[model samples]
Target: MRAAKGAKGFKIIGTDGLPGPAGGIEAVAKGGWAGTFTYPTGAKEAIEMSKKILLDCATSVEPTVTVGTTAITAENAKQLMGK
Candidate 1:
């Protein structure tokens, strides 16, 4: 916020639209950002694959996994934030 103070036409686009006081949601809600995005870490997928490899003794799993993401802007930020 301090960096953009008194600066004209400055915009902030953040990542990890997480919850909490200091997260991207709050930043956007407070007008400190134009928008933000959430990046899935694929931890759940990794765990599931591990289970298949260990329990099922799978020979191989999918070579790649695609995670999903969400875009948070003023239009939906408030709704996503449950505000």
Candidate 2:
């Protein structure tokens, strides 16, 4: 596995790079957090509304969306994801 520059001890080789004879390793993108959800319906709508709320709030106060590469890291992993 190849590690990304400035990632410290983290190795993010990803799915594209496995040994020639991949030992039963199937790399697939697992569906993760896509924002809040509601039973029956309105999951996407809820997320949109939440974004709007966040945008409105950010107009007055600084706001951060912890998405993409910025969200996942070794330091905050345990705290955000738990044990």
Candidate 3:
């Protein structure tokens, strides 16, 4: 995920790509809300590039966490939510 402080508030983005499905989420941290988008295949590169842009925006505001498959499990989600 990536996060940045926007003119209105902070923004966060999350992305993932799987064999037959791909999706991403863009979030505004100020109100703890988000929106999502999905694409079947051809837009993979664009999705990835958008993620990079979000990360770049975040770099100026806060640290970012980028992890592979193993770290995004239900157990981890629970742990993070607990904090």
The TM-score values for the models, in the order shown, are: 0.83, 0.21, 0.19
lDDT of 2 by residue, 4-83 (tens): 34345433423222112231112211211111111224456657657766766544432543322223333333333321
Name model 2 segments beyond 4 Å from true: 1-10, 13-42, 46-70
Q: After superposition, how far is residue 59 of candidate 2 from its true place, in Å?
A: 26
The top-ranked prediction according to lDDT is 1
lDDT by residue (1-83, candidate 3, tens digit) is 32443445554333332222122221222223343222235355556656766865544432443332322232233222322
Maximum-TM-score candidate = 1
Q: TM-score for model 3?
A: 0.19
lDDT of all the models against the reference? 0.85, 0.32, 0.35
Ranking by TM-score: 1, 2, 3
Error of 2 at 4 (Å): 13
Clashing pairs for model 3 are none
Off by over 4 Å in 1: none
Task: Report clashes for each candidate as comma-separated counts.
Answer: 0, 0, 0
Name the candidate, 1 or 3, with the larger lDDT value.
Answer: 1
**Candidates sorted by lDDT, best first:** 1, 3, 2
**Preferred candidate (lDDT higher): 2 or 3:** 3
